[model samples]
Target: MAQRILVIGRSPGVILDAAERLRGKGFRADATNQFDDVLTDYDTATVDVVVFGGMVPPDSKRQLRDEISKVNGHVTFVQGLAGIAGLIVAQVESVTSAAGDDTGVEYDAAERTVRLTLRQPAQVVVEAWWATSFTPPEPASTSTRVVDSRFDPGEHVVPLPAEVPAVASFVTVSVGPAVHTFTVGAMPDAVRRMASTSALPPVRAVATHTYG
Candidate 1:
C-alpha cells in the first residue's frame, strides 16, 4: 500500500501545497482543515506520517498529540514554522510559527540536497557557513584541521580533544516526546561525511493526524 500521510492545520492552501509535495515524492497525502475531524479519521486509517502546517494551538496540539500516541507508537511529526523566532520555539511537537533569527537546515539524504531557511530582520553571511566530515586518522591527534578552498585557504583545523566532544556551535533543542536536539555547526562537512560513510539514512516522510 502507498504510504499514508495526514496534514493538520487551519490553512488549506499550505496544507494542500505540502500534500502535493508529498504526493510528488510518492506518498499518499491527505489533508484536513478541521483539526477535530482529522483525529477521528486517523483512529481508523493507518497513517504513516504527520505534518502540521503551522503552529497548532497549545491546548489542541497537546490533546491531539496525546490521542495519537495512544494509537500510533512511533508516528514521525514535522512542525513547519513561518519565521526564525517561530522556528526556535517550534521544536515542540505542535508549535509552528515563523522562521526568525536562526537558520533552519534540512538535509534530504535521498535527494542529496540540503535546504536552508534564513529568517529576515537579521543580516548574516550565510554563504560563509561550512560543513564537513571528521574521522580519526591513525594516531588520533588532539586537534584536527578542516580545509575548504571555498571559505578558508589555509587548513582550518579545530581541536577535537575529547572522544566525541560537542562542538560549540551545536546546541540541544527538545522536540516531540524525546529531547531531540540538532547542531548547526559545520553542517556541510558533516553532511558529506555522513553521505560517504552511510551513517545516516534518507529522511523519512513525517506523519500527522487531526482530532476533534
Candidate 2:
C-alpha cells in the first residue's frame, strides 16, 4: 500500500508544489500551509508520513511534532531541508525503506553516470528531459529520451545515455518504486561528455517507446 503523507509548512507555494510532485510519484498526499489546521487534519486523516517544509516555524514545528507523536508513536516525521520536489521525495523514500526495498541508486551528473545497488531483480528506466522554456517551477515545454532494461540483483554502473538534447534540464532514473533525479547543468557540452562513454544501450530521442 502507498504511504499517505501530510505536507504542512509556512510556505504555501512550497508545500503545495511538494504535494503535487508527491502525487505524481504515486504517493497519497495532502498539504496545508496553516499551522493551526495541521493537528485537526492529522488527527482526522490517515497519515503515515508528516513532512514539515523548510520554512516552518520552530515553535509550531516542535509543538506539532509533540502532539502528533502522542497520537501515533510509530508515524514517521521528515524535516524538509529544501523546497525541491525531488529532494522531498527522496527524504520520504529514505524513511520508508524499513524492509530494504530501496534501489540504492546514485546519479553523478558531472560524469553523467548512474550507479545502482539493486537488492533484487527489477526493471530499470532512465530518462532525460530537455527544457524548451526557461520557466520556473514547471517547464513550459519539454522533450524526453529514454533507455530501459531488466537488471539483475547486485551492483551496476551505467553511463548516462548520450544525446540528451541540447537543452536538457535533468535526468530521471527509475527502478521499481524508486526515482532518482539529477540536474545536469548546461547542454550540448554536457551531452557530448556523457556520450563519450562506450556503453551499449542507445537512448530513444522521443517518448514513443523505450530502448532495450
Candidate 3:
C-alpha cells in the first residue's frame, strides 16, 4: 500500500501541486486548507504524514498537532519552511526513512572535511554555513560551502565546497532525507575542498519542525 500523505496549507495551488507531485512519486496524496476538515479527515482515515505550509498560523498548527496526537501517536507532522515544493517533499521522504539509527558523521574545521557513514547507497548533501543570530540563514545567504550527490554506503571523505569566514559556524550532511548538523569554530582561512575533479548539482535540506 502507498503511504498516505495529507498536505495542509492556506494556498490551494501550492497544496495541490505538492500533493500531485507526491502522488507521482507513488504515494497516496491529498490536499486541503480547512482546519476543521483536517480533524474530520484524520478521524475518518489513517494519514501517515501531515505537511503544514507557511500560511498556516502557529496556533492552528499546535491545535491540529495536539488533536492528532491524542488519537494516533504514529502520524508524522512536518512544517513547510518555505513555499518550495521539493523541500516539503524531502521532509516526508526523510521522516519516513528515519527508522534505523545506523549513521555517523564527522566534521573537521582545520581539514575542511565532512566524513559521513551510511548504511546504504544514497545521494548525499554536505553543507556548511555561518549561522548567526544577526544574520539568519533563511533570509540571508551566509553559507560557506555546499556539495551534493557524492557518496556510497561505506565511510567517505568530502570537502566543504566553500570557504568559511573567521567565525564559528555549522556543518551538515544529508543522506536521503536524514540530515546531521555539526558545530565548528571560526576558521577565516578555510578554503573550498572538492571530493572530485568533476562537478555535480547540489541537494540541500534544512531544519524542519516535526511533531508526533
Per residue, candidate 1 scores C-alpha lDDT tens digits across 1-212 of 65666776544444555566656645676766565666655552366666654334556666777778778876767654321212222233222222322444443333322343433222211111111222311101122222212222222222222332333122222211222223333223432333234333332233334221
- Measured on C-alpha atoms, candidate 1 has an lDDT of 0.40
What would the per-residue lDDT of candidate 2 be over residues 1-212, giving only the tens digit for each residue? 87788877544445666677778877777777666667754552357898886445567778888888877867888886344455566667656644435678887766777788988998887766554542222223343546688999999887755666434456667787565666564444533332233442332121100100
Query: What does the lDDT come to for candidate 2?
Result: 0.62
lDDT of 3 by residue, 49-151 (tens): 8888755656777888888878877788887644435445656766666456567777866787887777778877866665233211122224544677856
TM for every model, in the order presented, reads: 0.40, 0.55, 0.56
Pairs in clash, predicted candidate 2: none
| lDDT (CA) per prediction | 0.40, 0.62, 0.61
Off by over 4 Å in 3: 41-45, 98-101, 105-115, 118-212
Model 3, TM vs. native: 0.56
**Candidate 3 Cα deviation (angstroms), residue 77:** 1.7
Candidate with better TM-score, 1 vs 2:
2
Sort all candidates by TM-score, best to worst.
3, 2, 1
